[model samples]
Target chain A: DQQVKQNSPSLSVQEGRISILNCDYTNSMFDYFLWYKKYPAEGPTFLISISSIKDKNEDGRFTVFLNKSAKHLSLHIVPSQPGDSAVYFCAGTNNNAGNMLTFGGGTRLMVKP
Target chain B: GAGVSQSPRYKVAKRGRDVALRCDSISGHVTLYWYRQTLGQGSEVLTYSQSDAQRDKSGRPSGRFSAERPERSVSTLKIQRTEQGDSAVYLCASSPPPDRELAYEQYFGPGTRLTVT
Candidate 1:
């Protein structure tokens, strides 16, 4: 069973618009969530993260919101740039998940200029 | 030395062959991890080693997969009796011990693409 899930396989947004990517988790034990971006033939790079203690966290044009009760999280990119196009993966882990992360299949984000 | 380095960026092995993939973690990073990304699959943790000792391996996909870190800085994932289903990109990452109160940002290597015919 997949503990973490990203329902959308792809998303497209116009440059300067807001892009929202959603993720859901089945395990309520997860306390921390992270997002990573990957380009072709490269490893996934850490993008942003949010802890359960807070409902939201933002960095530059990127914001991550977590709804603990709903077991859902979303990543928002405002003023999306063409460079933001890549595969986005949502990952989750708990204090006791043995420090191992569970990752979603990933969502491909495309920003049109 | 500079960052995590994986050797032989690509390797092609025939079915039933044995293969070894290597990883060199950043200096002083005590936590090392191995993960695999198969087509249409998420990056799945295969094993983790802390300062040369494997702490958990429940994520290992099968008996054909084996990993070892004899030292704090280097690790190797070896596959025996390779099968066509074994093709995928193998990634290695390392981070400072979480006890250090450092961000759990794992620095990853370019990865080794294993293609089994």
Candidate 2:
């Protein structure tokens, strides 16, 4: 079974607007969450991460919000640029399992300029 | 020299043939990982190594699939008697020591796409 789930397959936003991507998990043992952005034919790059102890973390124009009670998290990109158009994946770590990471399907974000 | 590098950007192999994919991690990185990504799906962890020692192999798909790292800097993933179902993009990543309080960030390579005919 999939422990991590990104229900949205795609999202669209206009330039200079806020783009939000959502993800959910079924495994309660996951204590750390991360976001990765990938371009076609390239490897995924780390974006931002948040610990279970905190509900939110921000870096520059990127922010991640985690709601432990609902087992849900989100990544927000403000002033979304054309260069920001790519697939975003949400991953979680199960510390009990030697930091094994589980990934979601991914969301393809398209920013219209 | 700066990021993870993988060899053979693309490979097409006939069924029952053996294939090897290579990964070179950044210098001084202690943790290495292998993952497989199928089309339209998320990546799945296949194995992990720390300083030339494999730490986890639970996600290995089958006996035909094996991995090794003779040194701390490079790793190889081998698939023997590859089947048609073995087609996927294999990814390699490296990271600093895993942190208990925070998730260790992994730097990934471009990946090698293997197509088993």
Candidate 3:
């Protein structure tokens, strides 16, 4: 069974627009959520994260919103640039479990110029 | 100053052969993890080590798989009698000590892609 899921397989957005990626989880024990961006052959690079305590967290052009009650979260990138195009993965972890993460399949985003 | 790194970026092994993958975590990082990512799938934990002590290894798939961290900074994942299903991208990541007040962000290495023929 998949504990975390990214329903959308791909997304596309034009430059200067906002791109939103959504994720959902079935495990209530997860208290921490993180986002990572991956290139073709490189490992994933950490992006922003949101603790269950807060509803939203933002860094520069990236923002993550968590809705614990709904077991859902979303990542928003404003003024999307072409460089932002890549595969995005959302992961959840229960710190007590040695911080092992359960990740969503991934969402590929294409930002057009 | 360097990020995590793995050796043998690509390996092709025949069925029933054994293969070993290596990982070098950043200096001073106390926690390391191994994960496997199959095509079109997210990563799954394989094992974890902290300060040279393995804290969790329940994610190991079977007896054919094992891992060791003789030192705090480097680790190895070995697969014996490899099978076609064992093919995947094996990733290694490292993190600083867990802190309740801070997020333990794991830095990953360019994974070693293992292909079983």
Candidate 4:
């Protein structure tokens, strides 16, 4: 069984618009979530992360919202830039297992200019 | 200043062949992890090491999969009697110890794509 899942296979957004990517996880033990962005021929880089203790966390144009009751989380990118085009993966982990992360299949995001 | 790195970025192995993939983690990082990414699947943790000790191997698919960290800086993932189903991208990541101030984040390598045929 997949502990984490990203329902959408792909998403497209116009530059300067808002892009939302959603993720759901079944593991209630997960207390922290992370998002990583990957470009072709490169490794996935850490984009943003949020602790389950907080409902939301933001960094510049990127914001992550978590709804524990719903077992859902969403990543919001405002004023999306063409450079933001890449595959986004969401991961969840329990505090006890800090080194092992459970990842979603990933969502491809394309920001058109 | 360097991040984690994996060697033999692409490897094509014939079925039944044995292969070894290497990873070089950043200097001073005490924790290292290996993960496998298969088509249409999320990345799965194969193993993790701390300093020079092998900490976990529960995620390994079978006896054919084995990993070793001879030292703190380098790790090797070895496959014996490879099968076509073994094809996947192997990724390595490293991070500081949990006691450190850094959050539970890991720095990943570009990964080695293994095609077993």
DockQ of each two-chain model: 0.64, 0.76, 0.77, 0.74
What TM-score does candidate 3 reach?
Answer: 0.96
Worst lDDT window (10 residues) for model 1 chain B?
B52-61
Clashes of 2: 0
Candidate 1 regions exceeding 4 Å error are B54-56
lDDT by residue for model 2 (A1-113), tens? 88899999999999999999999999989888899999999999999999899999999999999999999999999989999999999999866665657889899999999
Off by over 4 Å in 3: B54-56, B100-103
What TM-score does chain A of model 2 get?
0.98
Q: Which residue ranges in model 4 land beyond 4 Å of their true spot?
A: B54-56
**Interface RMSD, prediction 1:** 1.4
Each model's fraction of native contacts: 0.49, 0.66, 0.64, 0.60
Which candidate comes out best when scored by DockQ? 3
Instruction: Report the candidate with higher TM-score, 2 versus 4.
Output: 4
Docking class of 1: medium
Candidate 4 C-alpha lDDT tens digits along A19-89: 99999999999988999998988888999999989999999999999999999999999999999999999
What lDDT tens digits, residue by residue, belong to model 3 across residues B1-117? 799999989999999999999999988788888889986678888888777775436565577778888778999888899999989999998888776245468888999999999
Q: In terms of TM-score, how similar is model 2 to the real structure?
A: 0.95
- Model 4's chain B yields a TM-score of 0.91
Q: What's the TM-score of each model vs. the native?
A: 0.94, 0.95, 0.96, 0.96
Candidate 2 chain B has its poorest 10 consecutive residues by lDDT at B96-105
**What is the lDDT ranking, best to worst?**
3, 4, 2, 1
Candidate 2, CAPRI quality class derived from DockQ: medium
For model 3, what is the alpha-carbon lDDT of residue A27? Answer: 96
Question: Across residues B15-108, which tens digit of lDDT does each residue of candidate 2 receive?
Answer: 9999999999988787778889886689998887677685336565577777888778998888899998889999998887655333367889
